[model samples]
Target: MKCPKCGKWSLMKFYICKNCGYKIDIKFEELVKRLTSENDDIFVSGMRDACSYTHSNKFYGVYAMEEAIKRKAKSENIDFYEPGFTYRSGIEYAEARSELLSLARKKGFLADVHLTQELISIWLAMYTHLDFNDLAEEIIEISKGLDEIHNFQLLYNQMHDTAVLNNNDVQRE
Candidate 1:
């Protein structure tokens, strides 16, 4: 059997994963079933999608988390300004996140309990970053270098333009 927590396809001789030491239990599935406000089909579909996604990717990059977000959007029937724009755009991330959270809350998602419990199932059934904050910090650090690169490219273009202007001036003289 596959280990839900670590997404490892190992021989399930125990209730815990040998690869990452994650415990398997029925509580997580129960929590998911209880907390979801949508029809069972949607919830099941979302969970299935999440599991499939995790299984395919081997639990990389917010596995079931994306499914949770997608499930919410699907249930609400809300159209995003741009689908997945927040993830790629730093400027609108916070605002878009706030809106999503508000919608989630309205749709009976209790972050401290319901959502958290559901997430545990998702985590156990998939995987999430143990060092999420550190990863975010590293991405931010790398983005600073992107600004430097952008500035250097602009500077190089200016220099090239000036050289061309100087060459034209010599031709005119």
Candidate 2:
């Protein structure tokens, strides 16, 4: 969630904004409603909330993510809960997909998510095909040129491995 006072992102588990020390009493359900709301502005607000919350943890974050996907489906006039309803091609769907993938990527990096090089390659490929900037301001809040990125690696080998995997993916393609 964002610090209402400073407008900076913060983890939902935190009641005080780290940047401005503003008290945050927003309810989780309220965030979810905004996420699933029909209003675009409200949806973006909810996306920012989900993005920050997912940054630190994936417990309730999953629900927030589900709501996003469901909203995307609704936008495309598809029933997300329908049996075997997978993905659809649409502007809103693509936007939501990219945002969700960015969130997953950030969550993976933050939580030491591990996969075979093959999987990582697939992930990188998908990410490359989509616009990373689509919902970046609201979703993945990457701190460019900061040690926060380099230091968040849970394991030293994981960081190096990710670099190697990216190189391999480039060479293979």
Candidate 3:
């Protein structure tokens, strides 16, 4: 396909234009879904590994925790943006969290409800960090106002807990 911005003929299916640095044929929604799915898987896998290591080796647990946090931050940042800019940020995060919860249940880790809660909280905090109060409030309002919205309360609660935890952590350290 030819580049939209630049009339360049290339064999690449979807990519930034080589000639004029313009984007080629691509679907933004599809890209977001694909990325969110991949990131969710990575975050879940990292969390599982981190939890497994927590009992045997503190250092490995810490490392895995850090990696999980990084992955979560990246996923949240990519998925959470202006409403018109992206459509599936909150949905993706919620879906990912649900999947993680299922996995945790299967692995006998869901009994620690607090851990799951903390994970969601951390994700919200990271998301809010990327998007300040104004954007966050806008996003929340939009989510709440939408009739089709799901898990709005869950995400909001998580965000609240995240803020509290973050403040406490900062005070402690």
Candidate 4:
């Protein structure tokens, strides 16, 4: 089995992520049982738990959850939207991330200082993660250093330069 938290392969018997110690003991049988449950709370809880396990692109639980969602909606005679994460190839993921960052930059450019700060906060949250610890720390420090509204322009300039560089890099690739 793959550990949903760390994307590492682990023996099924271990029920743990070898790299991050995240619990991977999702009981498949129990999850299926809950899907068939009549109680709304139990079924909904199962679905929510299933969504969390979707970080592992290879995990079967995501498909099971999708099927369960479809079955439930059909039986209940309603339209439905599946509520779990979708797996994307590396290139697709990169493109989506780039688009999102571009949108944020454009919006921040037109926004007031308060809105710009909010946008920056959201961008940092989405961009910074464990894999980029040093980069994340540097970004956080830069954001913090921009204490005055006047300094916001500096941040915007840096973001624009980054976007230009990212575009060049992508083109080269």
| Top candidate when judged by TM-score against the true structure | 2
TM-score of each: 0.23, 0.30, 0.21, 0.25
Point out the higher-scoring one by TM-score: 1 or 4.
4
Clashes of each: 0, 0, 0, 0
Please, what are the lDDT tens digits per residue for candidate 4 over residues 94-113? 55434434433443322343
Superposed by TM-score, candidate 2 places the C-alpha of residue 39 at a distance from the truth, in angstroms, of 1.9
lDDT of 3 by residue, 1-173 (tens): 56534557765635866677776435432322232233445434433443443334333333333222223344322221111122346655656445444533343222333444444444454365544344334433543432111122223333343334444452211
Task: Tell me the tens digit of each residue's lDDT in model 1 across 47-143.
Answer: 4543443334333212233323333334423221111112223434334333423423343222222333222222222223553334334433544
lDDT of each: 0.35, 0.42, 0.38, 0.43
Q: Quote the positional error of residue 112 for candidate 4 in Å.
A: 47
Which runs of model 2 end up more than 4 angstroms from their true locations? Answer: 1-26, 68-173
Per-model C-alpha RMSD: 21.9, 16.5, 16.6, 18.8
- What order do candidates take by TM-score, descending? 2, 4, 1, 3
Give the clash total for candidate 1: 0
Q: Model 3 residue 15 lDDT?
A: 84
User: Model 1, stretches more than 4 Å misplaced?
Assistant: 30-173
Quote the positional error of residue 21 for candidate 1 in Å.
1.7
The alpha-carbon deviation from the true structure for residue 77 of candidate 4, after best TM-score superposition, in angstroms, is 18
TM-score of candidate 1 relative to the true fold: 0.23
